[model samples]
Target: MAMTLSTPPVPADWTRHTPFSDPGRHAELLEDVAPSPEAIGPVVRNLLAHYRAEGVNMPVSSRDDINLRWVEEMLSVDQERHPGRSLQDPRATEARLQGCCRDHTLLSVSILRGQGIPARSRVGFADYFVPGWHSDHVVAELHDGERWRRFDPEVAPESGLLPDPWDLEVGPGAPFTTAAEAYRALRAGELDAASYGVAPDHELSGDAFVLTEVFWELAHRYGDELLLWDGWGAIPAPEEEMSEDLLALLDEVAEQLIAADAGDKDAEQALHALYVRDDRLHPGERVLRFSPLGDGPVAVDLRRGEDAVTRPGIP
Candidate 1:
């Protein structure tokens, strides 16, 4: 009932890009890069800098609002920031695109796929960032022929969080815990919900945040790869009250995710079936984006490129 899974073989779809990870016109930027994390991690680090960490002191105007959800948009911003610089070159902290863990994972995935490698992003809580605090995070996983390997492109060698940040071992005692694993742990009274969330000091730490993250993990697994703040369907708003029924549904979801991740063929099929049938599990055409930059909640049309409709009073 821990909802943990062993590493499984890579899916063919993961070798390709989803709408969020696709580099579009800038796909050329990722070309010629080696598929291994050793080669790709540095490129990702150079192209984008963490808004809160490396670029924290950046001007208010430049920070926060620039969490480019799409890799194409991120690449566009990078080009505008530093023209003619190759992806391998070091970008000035100011020139790097401002984003969080998800951006790092997505860009890394895009680059890997471009090099014909099977890669995907994982949404979970990383306990390595702060002692006793599990912050919501995203990491990339690539299939190196035999099995899947998880890595944190956002973590640099200087951080000293892991022996090698490019390759990470996840699960029980490991630094990272998938949302499904955390959910199962919470239900079993093995873990405290309050300890898992956005940050140690942020107000968004609780059971509800963990529940939303279960859906976040599923979405990423199924190729949606949405931004950390994007919410749709069954994903609850911070103010919304959760009913007993919704919690039950999430319990079932966590179970399926765990089994599927372990390469249970039947569980994989069932999980996909559940995602397709449940609007609560997968996003629709539009989603409510809760911007961390204080832009307020707005309805984003997935079909419309970068056009966010300001729907007043949509909590």
Candidate 2:
């Protein structure tokens, strides 16, 4: 009779904000930033510019519809491209903000949860850019009050490809992998679900894009910090098909997200009670997205209450 669990909010309660990492009114542009990924990873790689790896040449209508899911609309489009500057200066990689790597991990988890620090965002599958593939990534974990590090604010420690892009080493020949550890290593065939995705000649990728990246790694670990091509609840539409009870409910959600990333508070309260009683695992009020700038599959509408200002495939 061993069953009685309910204590799961710790990790400094992720410092706060998760309507896609808030930062409203630009939260004073992360008030003097510095919760440390060596000062929030080069201010999120100089306020983002990786629309497709560093040598950013801009304009395919400005890096194809960058789905900026609120970090106050990516600091209001980086204050309309460097207006009052100083998100710690140094712009000019095509004046920044084109985004990818999940907008450099949701603006470095919204400046480390606006400096109170807890942080989040994981999604996963990196294998260092693309030699034998495994692309699909998104980093930032934070919580350094004594654990959870795993950074890579879109890799830039002179791109030696992480010996410590601020402490990475995720597991099994490490270089990150958590779409529930690449869906339990592609159901234990031990890897090669079409070499993992979105790059090695991008036609999306295999094992149903690692089962929609394990429902985008539990909707960015329960916070609903979405947009890794945002689809909604129970996420299965790239011509939907996987069913053997949805691959045994994503193999018990990739074994409780790898035992709640190895700390396992009853596997993080059974993955927060199966992501709040599973409405196909969370994300209601509309989702569909898919636009890698082509703006095809829209739907969006996430309520947008408090006088919402626009975030449906951000043109």
Over 4 Å off in model 1, which ranges? 1-12, 304-315
Candidate 2 lDDT (Cα, 0 to 1): 0.75
Candidate 1 residue lDDT tens string, 146-265: 667899988877879878887788656978889999989888888888888887767798877887788888888877888788888877778887778889998998998888777687
* TM match of model 2 to true structure: 0.33
lDDT accuracy of residue 171 in candidate 2: 76
How well does candidate 1 score on lDDT at residue 34? 66
Position 248, candidate 2: lDDT: 89
* Whole-model lDDT values for every prediction: 0.77, 0.75
How close to the true structure is residue 53 of candidate 2, measured as C-alpha lDDT? Answer: 70
State every prediction's TM-score relative to the real structure.
0.90, 0.33
lDDT of 2 at 16: 67
